[model samples]
Target: MDRTFTEHLLQWYDANRRDLPWRSNPEPYGVWISEIMAQQTQMERVVAYWRRWMERYPDLGSLAAASEEEVLKVWEGLGYYSRAKNIRKAAELILTDHAGVFPDEIKQIQALPGIGAYTAGAIASIAFNKVAPAVDANVLRVFARLLDIAEPVKAAKVKQEVEQAVLPLIPEKRPGDFNQALMEFGAMICSKRPDCDQCPMSQHCAAFANGTTGERPVLPRKRKAIHIEMATGVLVYNDKVLIQKRKPDDVWPGLWEFPGGCVEKGETPREALVREYMEEVELEIYPAEKITVVSYSYTKYRVTMHCYLCHSANNGQLKPVFNEAVTGQFVSPESLSSYAFPAGHRRLIECMLDEAWFDNLK
Candidate 1:
C-alpha cells in the first residue's frame, strides 16, 4: 500500500468533497440509497430523486411495508426499474433476516438482492466505516490510468485485479472517507479527460507520467444502436383507458402500459396496435387518431413508438374479459399516476393531459 497516494486522496477529499446530504449525516440506509441511485444516473439527478425517496420511505420498515407499485412509482424515471424492485426486496429481507438493520459486514451486504461487490463495498465501507475497497467505474478508470493498465477495465479478470489492488490501500482509520475520496477524485479529476492540473495524485499516475492517459483505461467498443418500431393503443372508454401489465418475461417487465407490441415487418403502426390488443388482451379495437409519436433510447435500443387513440370495434361493448394469461384494467385519466409507466409512456401521458384527450373518447 502506497501511503502517499492514500494521503493525497484523503487530503483532497477533505478540502473539496461535494457537500451531499448523505455525507453530512452518514447512516447505513441513506448511504445505501444514495449509492444505488448514483448508478447510471447523474449525481445532480440522483440528489433530487434520493431526497424525495428518503422523505417518503425513510426507514427499512417504511420501504419494506410499501407496495411494489408504490416503490416502482417512486423510482419512476430512474430507468433500471429492477434496481428499485431489488431495493424493496432487500429491505424486506433485512427486516426478516437481519432484524431490519443494514448489514455492516461486506459479505452480508453483498448477499442482499441488488448489492454486487462494488455496491457492497461502497455501502459497507462508506456507511458502516468497514475497511472495504469500493471499486466503481470511476475507481476502475482512476486505477487503470494510475497503473497504466492496457487491458479493458470492464473485463471480469481485470476488474478483479483492480479491486484487489485497492484493498490494501484502504486505511483502517476513516476507511469510509478514504473510499469516498477515491470515488470523488476519479469522478472530478481522473475522468475521461484527466484534469491533471487539479489532480492531487497526478504525480503517482503512471499513465500521466508516461503520457498515455488517453489510452490507459481501455474500454470495449459501444454496441451498435438497434432501431425498433413499436405501436401502442390507448383504448378509451369514456375518461378511462385500458392498460395491461407486461409479462414478467418481457422487456420493461411487470410495468403497466397501454396495450401494444412491436411493428412487425411491413406492418403499419395502426395494424400492429390492433393485432397486439387482440392477441394480448382479447380486445378487438380500431386504431383511431394518432395521439403522439415518441422517440427515445435505452441502452443500445432506439425506439420509435407510435401511440394512438383506439376505440372498441365491438359496437361500444367495452367489457374487457381478460383470459387466464393476461392482467389488465380500465382506469380513469386521473388514476394513471397510481401505477408506474415507462418514461416514454409517461411522456405520452403528458401529451394526453396537455390536450385533455380523454374528452374526445367516444
Candidate 2:
C-alpha cells in the first residue's frame, strides 16, 4: 500500500500542481519566508504578502538588517506580528552564526527562533531536498483518512502516528516535491469534504474503504472566545494625537495604539479611559467625546475598545511617563498610518477617517 500510494500520489501531483511564484525557483531563503508567512494564513492571502515581503527584503541580508519597527510595518495586517519578529531574529542568527546561509540540517534550522519541528521539516525537505515529513493541517487531514486513524488529529499522539506512517513515503530523489505534493493533495482533493471518486489514492485509502471519511480525522471541540472591554484616549495637542507602543511582552507587542487599559468592574468606558491614561502615561486629560468603538479578536479574546477624544490637556502636563508602553509619541493626524497599530486601533483610525474626525482636530 505504501509503495503504490507513493507512486500514485506523485503521478497525480505531476499532473495537477499549483503554479506559485516561489515554486518556480524554490530558493532556500524564499522558501523559508513563504513557509513562515503561510502559517495560519490562507494561501491566496499569503501569496500577496510573500510577493510584497520578498520584494521589500529581497534576501536574508536585507531582512536581518531591517529594524523591528520596519519589519512589523511590512507585516502589518498579516495578523501574527510575532512571526515577523521571529523571522528577523532567525535571519540575524543565520548571518552571525552561519555566515548568512540558511541552515541545511533540520536540527540547526529548528534551533532558530519560532521554527518548530513542523516548520523545520518543511524547510529541510522543501529547501534542502531532504527526506523529512512536514505535517501541517492539510497533511494531518489527509493522513488521518488515508491511514484511518480514529483519534482526534489535534491529539499529540495521533499527530505522531501520522508522521511516522508518512516518513517512509518520502522519496529520496524528489523529497521536496513529494512533501509539497502531500500538502497540495490534502488542500485540493482530500480536503474536509474529500472527493473520493477523484482521489488517486482512493483505492489505497482505509477510510474510504471503511466508509468513515468524515469521521476519520476527528476534530476537537472549538473553544469559546473570552470577552474583554478596554478603553483608550486620543489626546491631541498642537494638531497631533498621543500614541503609545505596547510593551514587548504585551498582547499587541511592537505595535502602536492609543493609551488605555481594560475596564474594571463598576467603571464606565469613559472613566476607564481617563484613569488608564493617567495611570499608564501620567497624562491628565478629561475624556470629552466618544470618537469610535472597535471590536476585534486575538487568540481567544474578543476585545471591544472604546476610543475617546481628549481635546484638552489638564494641568498643562504634556510630557508622558511610560508604564503600559515602551515609548509614547504625539504624531500628526496625517502620520498615523506611518506606525503599525493593532487591528482594533487600526479600525479606529478607519472609523475616524470615515467620519472626517481628523478635520475637527485641525
Clashing pairs in 2: none
Clashing pairs in 1: none
RMSD of 2: 1.8
Clashes of each: 0, 0
Error of 1 at 325 (Å): 6.6
Tens digit of lDDT per residue, candidate 1, span 256-315? 888787999989999998888888778789987998999988989999999999888886
RMSD of 1: 1.7
Alpha-carbon lDDT, every model: 0.88, 0.88
For each candidate, what TM-score against the reference?
0.95, 0.94
lDDT measured at residue 31 in model 1 versus the true structure, 0 to 100: 93
What are the per-residue Cα lDDT tens digits for candidate 2 across 16-108?
Answer: 998889999888899988899989888998999999999999999999999999999889988889999999999999999999888899999
| lDDT of candidate model 2 versus the reference | 0.88
Candidate 1: list runs displaced more than 4 Å: 321-326
Which candidate number has the best TM-score? Answer: 1
Q: In model 2, what lDDT does residue 3 have?
A: 72
Error of 1 at 58 (Å): 1.0
